[model samples]
Target: KRSCTHRYCFAVCIKQDQRSRHARGTVPTSKERGVREEQIVKKIFATMVGSSSSWSTALVKISPYTFASIGIAISIGVSVLGAAWGIYITGSSLIGAAIKAPRITSKNLISVIFCEAVAIYGVIVAIILQTKLESVPSSRIYDPESLRAGYAIFASGIIVGFANLVCGLCVGIIGSSCALSDAQNSSLFVKILVIEIFGSALGLFGVIVGIIMSAQATWPSKG
Candidate 1:
């Protein structure tokens, strides 16, 4: 009887230790582990989504002046790039053609002038954009009217810049062709010159639209 009693007590002690371990979570079930993993995943997902939203909000809250400045730079820089490209291509062709037909040199100068006009268009748009900029304080950077005006000016700059860029390229390509054709037959000069004029008008159209778009872009004064 003493031996039997000892065996029974040992078995009970083992069962109690197992129960305690289970309660203390030292021995978690498959379901419990799965639940914990799911909770962790949920928390990570929530954190990622929150961070993305916060980043977007931060971008939206950036100062309008920053956008305006970028717009102005793009207008001038891109226009200059286009003009330079046009001048390079046209000037090269003009020089080659002038070597054979010296008289074409004076007439072909009109092509270079057209390319220069593209840069002028950019300068005009940049000046207009600069005038629209106001010295807004950091505290008032989120003003709605200011933001609207800034966006308008920025869009205007983009329109004029891109339009003038295309115009310059168009004129340059045609001018090159014109120079080559005129060297072959002088009659082609006037005909090609008309097409060049039309190409230049594209830049004028952009300028008109941009100016109109920015006409109503006045920021509210500090009250």
Candidate 2:
């Protein structure tokens, strides 16, 4: 009889232990596990959705004025650098050639003028961009219109800057060649000058395009 009673008590203790484990969630049932997995999936989905929206909002919050300023700086800075580079290369060649043929001095000045014009193109584009920049209220800084305007202005500046930079280098190299050729044979001066004129026109093309691109970029007003 005592053995039977002991066996029954042991069974009751095992059952209690099992019940406690289930109640404490140490052993989750299939249904409970599925519910947990669903909750985890929902949380992950919510997190992914939140992160995606935050990325877009962060992009939109970027200051348009900052990009515009950088654009303007690049346009002027790169154009000036190109012009200076061209002038340096051409001037050295021009001075050397002039020493051989003094008569070509005045005529070869055209090349220098063309190089200088590249810098002017940058300045013109920069001015246009500057004018397009307006003081906007804090509320409009993240507006879609403002973002569009900023991007347009930045693109315009980049287009003008790079075009002028290339144009300047082309003119300078060609100008140097022209000076040397003129010293050797005066007839080559006009032919080479024609090519230089075409090279200079490349910068003009950039200016026109930049102007057109920035034309529609207007900052939104508070009103």
Best prediction by lDDT: 2
Worst 10 residues of 2 by lDDT: 39-48
> Whole-model Cα lDDT per candidate?
0.84, 0.87
- On residues 1-223, what C-alpha lDDT tens digit does candidate 1 reach at each position? 9667655655665567568778988976778756755655565456546667788788679777877888788788888888888898899999998998998999988999999999999999899888988776666777888888888888888888898899889989989998999999999999999999998888899889988877867877766
lDDT of 1 at 198: 98
Clashes of 1: 0
What are the TM-scores, per candidate, against the unseen true structure? 0.76, 0.74
Best by TM-score: 1
Off by over 4 Å in 2: 1-58
Q: Candidate 1: minimum summed lDDT over ten consecutive residues — where?
A: 39-48
Per-residue lDDT over 22-128 for candidate 2, one digit per residue giving the tens place of the 0 to 100 score: 89889867787567656555655565466677887886777999888988998999899889989988999999988879998899998999999999999989998
Q: Which ranges of candidate 1 are over 4 A from the true structure?
A: 1-52
lDDT of 2 at 217: 90
lDDT of 1: 0.84
